[model samples]
Target: MQHSVMEEGTAYEPPTYDETFPVLPESASSSSGRLNIFSINNNLQLGRITITQMFRVPGEERKFDHSDKFGERESIRTCKTIMKETNTIIEIATSKDQSLTFLITGKQNQVLEAKRRILTTFQTQASKQISIPKDHHRWILGKQGQRLKDLEKTTATKINVPSVQDQSDTITITGTKEGIEKAEHEIRVISDEQI
Candidate 1:
């Protein structure tokens, strides 16, 4: 039977030793079917020193059963969660193993913040917030809302600019802690540029 061995599970088999007289070449052996293979990789002479071997684990092997269905299911679940939880619409690309890459488009700052938050929340398990000044808010928000829109698109964070009547100078950032820091830092930098 043809079988492929994978590095998984817990089963060990010791290799049998050759105790007989050495009358033949090293390429020939009679023992457990562990194939020790050696070859000169490329045309270089020094490549002959390294040896490679293929081993068969009696019953341990990996079979990939799910293909597109598994990835689609995971993507759907993640998309649903992202839509329901946040005010952002994001496109998801998933690998066969259910890994995700988000292609998000929205306000520049919001997007950047969101990406930052998503990365940090899943990768670093951190959370935080940042505040932006009202005067500098115009810079972050930009002229005719273009600059602000650009900020949202770049940061991936929803930038909440309080109305003149709100009497608040702080622009609230909602996303992952790292994202918040990044968005906040960018806005501050923009503010500094105006001065």
Candidate 2:
């Protein structure tokens, strides 16, 4: 992992347990997965963050007669409600070109949850069903699902390629219609490339 970043021209090295991190006592560790993860990531920064995301509403969904760009300020209302519920900070701005900008600041999980909710609720999302051999699911998911995460972030879609246990054949994709098609095509491409 360290060597990979070095190859990418990162000036400083990522922290390792040798110097900055602490080793936990056997007695202090427990069975809870989340706790174990928190301990491991303690060396990683957990500071608050502020991010801005901007995008224009699709023309078909635009309501020109309305005040806001998309004519659906419901997205704002939903986000505000989620912020209040999660105790996160979210500020929204509009642009002349029918764009909506989101200013979000909060803890790591808080920001992620708020942003996900905003995107899923506000955007034009759809679900598509694809049947791939259950055994091939892992190829699409990749190791620890890093591949699927990358695909989602790249295509702005969510892909559910079934687990080994369920033996389910149907993979459900939920996102923009375009994103679904992109993800589906990429999944097939990945499967083909692997072969």
Candidate 3:
């Protein structure tokens, strides 16, 4: 048998079988199961977890009264903001009965913080309805509802003005007792100006 010889002062290198076996594609080599295991391990190391929570919105504060033009409800917007601020993920689903279910994912501390903020924001609150002339609704709404939005922001309340089609003069304000009182005062001031 002939013996193979390596050149002196040269390091030995292993032979590669380039064509013997087909190289696996990146995706094939990293199977989803293995990646999932890795992800689980990483999350364990990071103390990440997912939790589900359900909250019942008061009947008086439904989306019809608090949604923006895009139809994103106020609670949804608030959750999204909380998610960003707390470095968490929040998924909101509205039930047929108007309850909100939140799927929150993050580290334990972050998830708890998000939950606390959401609970505080959506806690039991007061609602007040005031009557104004239908004609003055336009003035209270201002151009594209800017005035109404400003009043809500300033008073920390949600104000729902009846749509023109509804033919209702009732305006709904929902928030803390102080907020409702402030908003009521403001709405009355605006309506009185229309006289």
Best model per TM-score: 2
Under the 3 Å rule for N, CA and C atoms, how many clashes does model 1 have? 26
Candidate with the greatest lDDT versus the true structure: 3
Please, what is the whole-model Cα lDDT of each candidate in the order they appear? 0.53, 0.68, 0.70
lDDT of 3 by residue, 1-195 (tens): 997798999998766654554456865655443333333344454344555444344433543535423225665577778989989887766666655556777776676566556544754567888888999999899999999877775565788999989999999988766668888998889889989
Clashes (N, CA, C under 3 Å) per candidate: 26, 0, 0
**For model 1, the run of ten residues with the poorest summed lDDT:** 54-63
Ranking by TM-score: 2, 3, 1
TM match of model 3 to true structure: 0.41
Pairwise lDDT winner, candidates 2 and 3: 3
Question: Can you list the residue pairs that collide in candidate 3?
Answer: none
The sequence of per-residue lDDT tens digits that candidate 2 reaches over residues 28-69 is: 465242343334555666545545444444534333333544
- For each candidate in turn, the TM-score is 0.40, 0.50, 0.41
**Candidate 2 clash figure, as a count:** 0
For candidate 3, the lDDT comes to 0.70
